[model samples]
Target: FINFPVFFSGVSMLIVVGVALDTSAQIESHLIERRYEGFLASGRLKGRYVR
Candidate 1:
């Protein structure tokens, strides 16, 4: 029974870290798209930006 708590804690930590990494990647992509738009006003960035 003692080991169960440790196992659950490790699993929960891993899940949280995975979710955080995914969210960070999404934010990074948005920042990159904004940066690209700032540099180029024309449609040149349309092909690279998703969503």
Candidate 2:
């Protein structure tokens, strides 16, 4: 059912997701190093920007 383009697209999406996760982890670690504690503590530290 899938063609070459479809397969390529899937791979591209996977790469994007991987990059986003890596970057988010780095940023979250940096935030934690700065002593920014939170209730979530689940690596979803995007909440810090809201404050």
Best candidate (score: lDDT) = 1
What value does the lDDT take at residue 14 in candidate 2? 89
Q: What RMSD value applies to candidate 2?
A: 10.4
Query: How do the residues 1-51 of candidate 1 rate in per-residue lDDT, one tens digit apiece?
Result: 355555568778899899999999999999999988886877465559666
Lowest lDDT sum, 10 consecutive residues, model 1, at: 1-10
lDDT of each candidate versus the true structure: 0.83, 0.77
Please identify model 2 stretches exceeding 4 Å from their true place: 1-8, 36-51
Best candidate (score: TM-score): 1
lDDT by residue (tens digit), candidate 2, 1-51: 755665578779889899999999999998887765553565666647653
Predict model 1's lDDT versus the native: 0.83
TM-score on alpha carbons, each prediction: 0.58, 0.52
Q: Clashing pairs in model 2?
A: none
